[model samples]
Target chain A: MINEEINEIQNIEIRLFLEALFQRYDYDFRNYSQAHIKRRILHRMNLNNFKNISEMQHRILYDPSFVQQILLDLSINVTEMYRDPSFYAAVRKEVIPILKTYPFIKTWHAGCSTGEEVYSMAILMREEGLLNRSQIYATDFNHKVLKIAKEGIYPIDQIKDYTTNYQKSGGKESFSSYYDANYNSVIIDSSLKKNIVFADHNLVTDSVFAEVNLIICRNVLIYFNRELQDKVIKLFLDSLAPGGILCLGSKENLQYSTHFEMFSVIDAHEKIYRKEYRH
Target chain B: MIEQKSFPIYKPLAIVIGTSAGGVEALTKIFIGLRAGFSIPILVVQHISPSSDSYLPKHLNRLTTVSVNEAIDKTSIEEFNAYLAPPNYHMLVEEDRTISLTVDEKVSYARPSIDVLFETASRAYGRNLLGVIMTGANADGASGSKLLREMGGFLVVQDPKSAHISTMPEAALQLAGADYVTNLEGIIEFLNQLK
Candidate 1:
């Protein structure tokens, strides 16, 4: 019973600490679920060797570097190249048919951490004969990650696996033909990235910038609470052109969202949706 | 009768562990004896195929007292818990207070790549972290463990000879120059002392 109370108290302290973080740092975590927020902060605290949250809070309030460290701990930066290959395959099979009808295309990949998906799209476009005419916008909230994304270099040892993913995603050519391995790292083909622009954008706090023909914001919205998710969905709706394509992560959906009626499913298994034309 | 002196216990805030082929059984043995209410948060990346679905967390949760779950995007790191990177994704902690999921491409033929997690965690946590590299058939986690040690994090490697697959630990020792090299039972005792 005493242990349970200690756990409860720790939970309360974590909440207050997060509240204090918002108040002090202007990073809005107020909308995040308490369980997730508590876990992240405690993880950060332990990493910093703080015996308790109070010590962590004290350091974070005073030290900007500590705040930055805390921020790094809290951000969800896990991702991979050709992630969920079937989704890309679906985009190639289902959406490209409609995309080919257009003369030119502009696509936005929101929350494009380190730009693997962006490059994947560019490769797909190239294969579909749409590369020269299409412009891809890959955006993320973290500037540091964006820089790495722009570099388009990955560990060379991983090529064999990514080659398999590439094949599974229906690559037309040899995966090795795409990049040059320089010892330990693989530098992606510069041609594939030519039409791509990597930038820093936040879905939580930012607004839509352009009317795009397709919007691919996969695996990003799941982190947000319901309200924040709605805000992002609305943002995507506003940004997408009529009859545009919208692709989401596997677990995410447009159902129950305010913009649900505005779009229809292109491929349910792949979670691909297309904005419907009113006229 | 000789009474044992209770030594001062050191608790790590963040624990980073790495494994490859034959790692599941090794991890099960190491984690099985962990005391209930152990308060450190652990981050682990086991080498799994991009298509492999890990039932590791579920299995570990059943055997251990700590809460275990697949690491989710934006999920906070918590005390007395364990997080395993889901298959086909490299798990990284961002500089901000949220989890970022990237589909950037695989490192060393792994999606939930051990090197990516260990390197990023070392960068994020520095000396306050504890790193353990375990049994496997590959050399994936070696360089990352080296970086963790260079950054002042505590290093622990599983005994290579005792491991079912020794290549991973042998590689890590050669590359990272581990601070503590022991068998599974020793690691459990070490963790219990912390608890």
Candidate 2:
């Protein structure tokens, strides 16, 4: 059918466009699943009202602004405060106890879109009386989301919902105590982010930059193919200190990865694993 | 010049879905109406605790005509059956066209993540896909559904009001801006009409 041919042509166009993007921009989506990459590119194309992928590629190649917009579309950066409240509850109950033994802590929240999870961890630390002794590194490939993460501002209306999640996550204090509500946004207390470093880092291209007592790279790796997943997990294994905790998104695990034996599940339901102390 | 085909036959081979918090009730309503002789494949990723042994397939299978089972790695994705992504792994369609499981980290705070399965299937099947975003708490499936829509695949979302948890559908509507928005009953009727 005519429609089927057009669909196939569109697929080819997206493939060519991504190839061009890597060749010129060096973003290296070459290893990502072809299906995911194509879908992302096509979404951008439609949003921009380009007739086809070729038009979107032409604009991306020539216009930096367009490329940035495409980057936002490509990153899949949707997140919310205490998005999975129970998961955080599990962290507070299971992981915090072990974290208390460490003299000082280094934590990493990889693919921390807009820093919600990072801030959530900061809140958890504050409650556990660990805030003063911890340093958190929050990283994402999308610079735009990273910028938002740094700002630490969120829609004021969402506070009600986030408060509910906060309570469900077993917050011991008033949720409103954490932020000052502005006209349309809530400015998170500056102190919560004091030890948090929001940075631009790509799991696809970047290497581990810190040795940490705990690494919480929740919900970021699913975008990649198996080979890429293996690569990222390896980075986490290398970065985690001996006996450090590695928390993953519930669906994520080290079981099938090359680093499977490097860590053992502490709370399998929570998807919390501990790096083996290889002495 | 080619003759235009009338009422382009939409023989839906598979149905893939992503949902968050309130997905269970919504899925039950939709599946209950799809009787045993239904010959389409259904794959679903509902956000659940990694430790929670989702007896979802078993529960839903009891209500629907179609066979339901939790997806296993390397299993062939077959028609007239439903596959639910297991609790802690991302489910993907391999190049060999079989179900491939990944221990990859969660995307969008979910394992058996909706985004992972939807995005991968969009790549594997292109327009030969039907992606649906149902009721849940977070925005997990929005971008993936958007991707499927762009790839010329059919897109559907549960009407936010009808969803037990509206966040997922609301977010999908805002981001992907779906092609069809309907209640669970309506979605069932739509699925029936797909053939």
Candidate 3:
């Protein structure tokens, strides 16, 4: 068959595969960016050594574990503490001051992934003296990763980079003081976890569950198609209290979002936007 | 932006460029040397530290007449512009010909893998995609260039001897020999002549 024919066939199979995922399980990834979903599908197919998406679909019918693996794979867990140092720095300089004015803070960290970012934010809040007055909902669709998040254990080797990021993000104290190295991994200070509630939240299907002063969704929006992105942004708009902050991934923006006018820029370079106080 | 159809006769709709170690200089040269108002959307993947700031576009935009900016997710492939992949993200071409990015595991030890972009661009643009491999220190783009060639897309390799670092161009030649192997000036001339 011709090359275009192959791509066409693979897409059809992928569509069926996504349908299978949504129907069999309640996970709806049908609206994800086709390119992102295609890459994930191809990656999984190569790993399983399946000749085609059809074979993958066939296995989906028989193996429950296979389904679980695929779902986990679909949820992007690629993140690190202080992934973008400047973003955290902006949070410290811009958002923290506003957060201080409020008596209490509520934060919804959508797609918390392995919890690196959630813990990173928790550390920031602790330093800013807002941890005790803050309630953070760190959530993801993947329960498996949520368990890892709750533990706050990361590789010791990775800690070095996180420390550098921490320092660059205007860290006030010794980074080593935040965690205890235990063998190959470092366990985060338990104090960071006290204000964070790790839970299950699927951005794809879930609605706004709370009113919050800050919403840090970050890179999670890029995985979605434009339509879904707008839908999710609406959910965020509804969830945020007026003048609340909504930070997104570096590449993601409200340029094409339907709800673009509803937010004002706090830090354009850092992708921090505040919901219009009156709106 | 001049239309690709205005090219009397042409084989490419998009140009994809990838490089590493010596990429900043090489890409700057290509962008500056190309005729003003070059209409093809040049998609570039240059290796840098994961936390590297958005310096490449700012640097290039000041030097080149072609508007250069970081590729945004779901952005369309418009004419007379260039898009560079963001640091620590894998930029792919969707079937709709828009850009899609991911933080998937690195390919060939590079987040914005040349192979990833080339392979996807070849699929999206088919024989109309022109894959360019220039000065670099890694073999990230070789396999992707090979796949691009397999999909009937064209390949352009910067002559290894002329490259500041020869490892990348030489690797591309060994794995996916280009339709045109030339120096920086020659590549620029070829692009300008596309009009």
Looking at chain B only, the TM-scores across the models are: 0.91, 0.92, 0.94
lDDT tens digits, residues A1-279, model 1?
443344456667776777787788767666654434555676677776888888887887888777766766666666667778888888888999999999999999998877777888888888899989998999987777788899999887777777877888998987787788897998899988888988878777789899999999887776566568788899998899999999998756677478788888988767899888983
* DockQ of predictions, in order shown: 0.06, 0.13, 0.65
Ranking by lDDT: 3, 2, 1
Give stretches of model 1 more than 4 Å off. Answer: A23-25, B1-195
Tens digits of per-residue lDDT for model 1, B4-23: 22332456668888998888
lDDT of 2 by residue, A73-167 (tens): 66666677886688899989889999999899999988898887788889989999999999898988888889999999999988888899889
Q: What's the residue-level lDDT of B85 in candidate 2?
A: 89
lDDT minimum window of 10 residues, candidate 3 chain B: B1-10
Best by DockQ: 3
What TM value does the first chain of each candidate achieve? 0.92, 0.94, 0.98
Tens digits of lDDT, candidate 2, B156-185: 888899888889888888887876777888
lDDT of 3 by residue, B13-127 (tens): 8999999998999988888888877788889999988878889999999887788999998899888789999999999998889998888889999998998899888878888
Q: Which CAPRI tier for candidate 2? A: incorrect
What is the DockQ of the complex in model 1?
0.06
